[model samples]
Target: MSDTELRNDGRLEDEHQLDADDRLRPEFVDAVLDAVENGDTEEAHRLVEPLHPADIADLFELTPDERRAPLAAAVADLLDGDVFAEMNDYVREQLIDALDARQVADIASELDTDDAVAIIEDMDAEDQREVLRAMEPDDRAAIEEALSYPEESAGRLMQRELIAVPEHWTIGDTIDYLRGHEELTTDFWEVFVVDPAHKPVGTCALSWILRTPRSISMADVMQREQTLIPVDMDQEEVALRFQKYALISAAVVDGSGRLVGMITVDDVVHIIQEEAGEDALLLSGAGEGDINEPVVDSYKARVRWLIANLFTALLASFIISMFETTIERMVALATLMPIVAGVGGNAGTQTLAVTVRALATNQLTQSNTARAIGREIRVALLNGVTVAVVIGVGVSIVFGNPMLGGVIAAAMMTNILVAGLAGVLVPVTLDRFNADPAVASSVFVTMTTDSIGFLAFLGLATASGLVG
Candidate 1:
């Protein structure tokens, strides 16, 4: 029998068995393609059935867009909510567009509020409304309330399906209620104990409930101190709290401190990933760097930064222009000029990256801002002296113009010292004005270093009469 036939018949040798990475093997992909081409739906389904939802999502992502519809159709029911939820936003939006509103709603209803909202929010407004119309009234209302919150807030990240019981309920009652309510959330680490007005008072872990006596009241069994996330709180703050407290799950409350939803580790995992990615992109002046972002959208986001950089570049050019007479007199000044500027720019960038990250993580705040800036200035002074001596001696010998060499070396030391100060101070100043430091810091820092580098180098050369 052929290898494919043997494999299909469950008679493949151990040598033919696929390793973890081999599933995406060219031959395996070809085999699946061949099955699809030959209309062998069963073979296609069998080939992909063993993969995890995330793997399935990956498979969809790797497949050409043209082939995704056919592959999805062949797999049919295998494209469950889990697989859909795990898909890339681009792929998910495409798949959702192909599915009917009711079909999309049915899939969403099976997911947690956060996942469902994530999928629904990506759809067009009309489609989102239609999908909500198809959901059960309670599910629709919960999702609507979640949607009411600002994007990237705790309210939107929280799951409306949570386990909460009256404080008066005993441990046995809570357990029985949990077992009896088929409609309750399937995944939860803690049950909230609430007052009659639905205000959260305490939380009881599932383990505690299971271990406690049947007659123990939830109010007595539950821990009174619990971290509650406010609905309007930023998702980043929520992530910090989770990280700080080592929280598996935390209750999300509204203005009245009434439990509205719950934020779990699983949901927080996505938030953490997103926030980290956002910060990285912001630091580089790349806004929301999604691969699937439309060309026009990407251009709009990036062009502004490029233009700002152009203006900054011009500022550096103006400073260079002021030293035109010096450069015309000694061409060697032009050659050595870039060395000072390049080193200073690089040093500035390093300090900027560190300071931006510290600010984002709340490590550099008003309380320590002055101290941090002072420390950077000190470090910069030390680095400046070390770099100056090395470059001064090296250039003095190479050019045989000790005065020119000394001028360039002195400029390097001065510019680098200023670079470090500008790097940290620019970000802090922008942040104080309620601007994102990462997005604007690079532009400002580059401007400062370039302008200062040119001014220091050329100004010193002219003053010392080295290039007259």
Candidate 2:
């Protein structure tokens, strides 16, 4: 095969491909680090030269903090727009901080409008202004317009470079225009056909344009049924629209319904990944939860949750204090009390995770809330009964007190049922009140399970005259 064909198929023999695990091997990373540390900049460049932009980003991430600058200097020429776009956010921020504002502007100018906004958005206001000043006027205007939108909105995510043709043009005219205009965006799946006022009326897939007769008018050949994303819509909502409508690309319109930009599937993929990770971190009260997150930031994010847990735990302790006399009288009650609380807490967490995820994905809506609740209640019943029987039988044999076992069993069932109810209700209630269910649900759920578990078990023992 010819060299061009070989490169296209990724079958070039000289290309350094990723390993089976798709990670840079330890030895390779070590050698490059050693080269940078030893002041062999040329050698370090040679080692990283064969890697792709993404792999080069990985190399920077893998290097020690002290070595990252030196390694970056070694591979400075290769750290282009693609490499910066592919770098981890924390790593990219570290590199951006190391560069001058003019240098940063140069890098931003090389990237697409959306990517340029992403890089600039994280800088402080003074640094942002400096960088924007250094950029070309047209690039600065596009970035400024994007930055005006709320963070995470479609306006921030959509690309400014898109093909929009007047609906009055025929296929032949459209084809000629596209062929002649070398300044048009190089990557677009569809052409948006707009009216005189720039309102998007229909969309024509590139494939459709290629197959249709050139004599046909753009208005007649274009598909009027199109998914239009609002400029102010959240990126998550934008992703959902793309998913629901099976859209490869959609026109983004302003409040007046004028076509402003386009959102393609590639942008949605990143939003989906970020949203998924954000929810998972929020559920655990671990802000960002990224390994690359700063130590001070991680501590600040986690300490407040830990403090909240401490207070809730004290509340559970107070309930146990009320039953201190009962626990002391029967050591068996003390031994088995933890089991009740532990099992109930596990059950509650399982339910909380499911409910939080469902709510985040819009799966648990008002129409299905009742059904979702009923389903969890039944699950709790089965789980409670099975656990109660196992613990009851074990206690009877070990403590030689079937009545005591029966008392503990009853407590287990009661606490588990309460846990199930608390788990679902806490998140749903928070969501209803405009709170993030994932961030606060676990705190409330754990408190409910612990306090109720202790109260039910001790209260049952006291009432049955099994203890005290």
Candidate 3:
């Protein structure tokens, strides 16, 4: 964060490499790349040395694609496992592809099993094997076990590195054992107390262990109640558990109930952020929505959703065709249709967003489904009536036709009711069938609002004889 004049030119003048927010300065990034491009390796190193690992990762992401390899080469000594861990997935993949198997293995060996798996899991299969071969037997074995589990499961997300000791050990003995070990876990908040079978009996926080007399037994100090995560539990569910319990760390266990690994709060924070962002993108029908995603990949992801929306729109179009004659009679009906559909669509989206979030967070469940639906319906009724009165009065004055105004008002109220119902029902039904509601709910909700909106307005007009 401090200033260093690593270069003479005004563009390269480093008042500070990072701003107050800790992000790498735009000019700072330019200076590093400027140094690298000009073959000033020492200058590049001097400019980049002040950054944290996360900021170093950001520098790579900010660098141009062609310059990334060169920038990486210039900062080769700085590109450790921590930098790679903080990096964006696609950006890391781009850089990983440039490294040889041994070089990749060296970096992976320095990280915990979970971090190593993140780097190696996306690699090409043959190249992955080569990296594994280059790694030490212990690191390779740990990573191989992690990769065998389903991606994004607790098994894949938990780190093999953790502290576990027998419950019978005295606090003094535990302290001695910890000090005696040269290869114990470097960072942990709690020491897991396990039974003779290595099944966790309780967790002893560092504070408890440090505060208590060392001569006291660990069993006397450990808290028996502890949250245990299933190895195969999905990471999203894992994050929920962590958030619900306010856990700093939890032991991950196998089906047989043996402690396998640990998930810390730091890792859960990333999963929580990732799952939240992913849900938002899915609701919008955008896949992944990563900025570093290739053009073809983004196109493939977005076009399918657009195509699905296109087909749903055709359904709405067909409904409109049924009332062509009625629309032609009033002319004004055409102008008002979009307003009904657009407002109803917005209302449905509002309901859908709330319902999906509730479902994801376990706030909405089978026991409360009826209550949630009823609550939304009541809100929708209020919304519908408020909207109906405004549009009804405006239409009556503007066109000087109370009958026409009445028809549009009735149509608006009916459509809004249908939209609210569809919004809640569509996602809940999808959830009931074990489908992901966020990914598929929007299409159906929009379709229902548009089709029902058009049908209600035109049908009410024809039925009311307003057009005749």
Candidate 4:
């Protein structure tokens, strides 16, 4: 979030409109809606104009979907590029669809290249072209170049506006350059020291430049050990690099090593949040589970997974059908089987969650794959032994049959062991094939646990002569 200057006029001070979390209060939202609904444009403007752009964006999100357009129209003047930058993607799309190309272009021009591309990248080709035609030449060129890069790549995420100077410049010369240039980017943490070809040679922190004497050369002050991101590098890896190095900013370089743009921590903050949330949503097969997403979109993302699960469920049924005679001979077996399946399913899910998280975070690598599997196996065995002993003694007392108890105890242990194996192996195997392990692993793991639980219990019972 931008350090949005507070509109802290006395009106909102008395209203106490924002909660402790900095979210706008429901009552305040209702008041804005009431004013907008009443066609009290002046009052609506007074209530909303004092909010920072991010808060304005939140107001739009908290409003009902149908009412959002009206709110956007009501506060049209206050809806700037910063507000759009902070909006939920679906909500921004909804509002963007309402405005003309010229208005959209006007907002895009107010932002840096990265922010502008983010707003324009989601538009239809025709609309994007129309908006591009309306923008100033320099802004249009920067955004067009950014759009040429792969989506969610370092090239697309970096801003063109940055401070760069030659390595030979002294502190005085650099400070003079900064002072004389009215158009220089205002928000930079460091100055990039570049060669004659505009390739970054080092980074000079703002603090270092200020503290150094006038005669100090930039090359003398700068740190050559800097992180350089390739233009085509994926955003997740970019975030990881930022986290690992604790970088405030990094220079993005083209394939030939020319500095193309700069990526700040602010830009990566959103990417980090987005990728983290995306992996989680993908794990549940809930595509981009944004609250503002349309009902139809939500349905389309969720149904395919449910359908996949339905087929897997059918396979489990087929396995149970194979043991029809055994269940018929022992009614108690039918009653006890679901416990085994449910517990095993829970165990598989636990392991799947851990394995997926480790894979996503790069905590699990090829070198440690054997160790991870070994660790899960050890955990599974300990869980199986404890659960088995409890179920074994309980069943013997409850049914007054030692043999039936032993059969189920043995089956429970085996199923849990299988569940643990499936949980870790399914995701790891998918990752090995370069498939997204989170998207399909849970379905496979759940199916394995359920099918194996039923098969193990019934097969053991029949083999032990506890059933016909």
Best by lDDT: 3
Lowest summed-lDDT stretch of 10 residues in model 3? 4-13
Clashing pairs in 4: none
Answer with 1 or 3, whichever has the higher TM-score: 3
Q: What is the C-alpha local distance difference test score of each model?
A: 0.86, 0.88, 0.91, 0.90
Task: Give one digit per residue, the lDDT tens place, for model 1 in 66-111.
Answer: 8888888899788888998898888888888999989998998888
Give the worst 10-residue stretch by lDDT in candidate 1.
Answer: 1-10
When summed lDDT is taken over every stretch of 10 residues in candidate 4, the lowest stretch is 1-10
Colliding residue pairs in candidate 1 = none
Q: Tens digits of per-residue lDDT for model 2 on 65-128?
A: 7788888888899898889998888999999999998889999988889988989999999999
C-alpha lDDT (0 to 100) for residue 5 of candidate 2: 12
Ranking the candidates on TM-score from highest down gives 3, 4, 2, 1
Q: Which runs of model 2 end up more than 4 angstroms from their true locations?
A: 1-23
Q: Higher lDDT: candidate 1 or 3?
A: 3
Clashes of 4: 0
Candidate 4's residue-wise lDDT over 196-303, tens digit each?
999999999999988999899999989999999999999988988999899999999999999999999999999989888887898899988999899999999999
TM-score of each: 0.91, 0.94, 0.96, 0.94
Model 1 lDDT at residue 442: 90
Please give the lDDT score for candidate 3. 0.91
lDDT of 2: 0.88
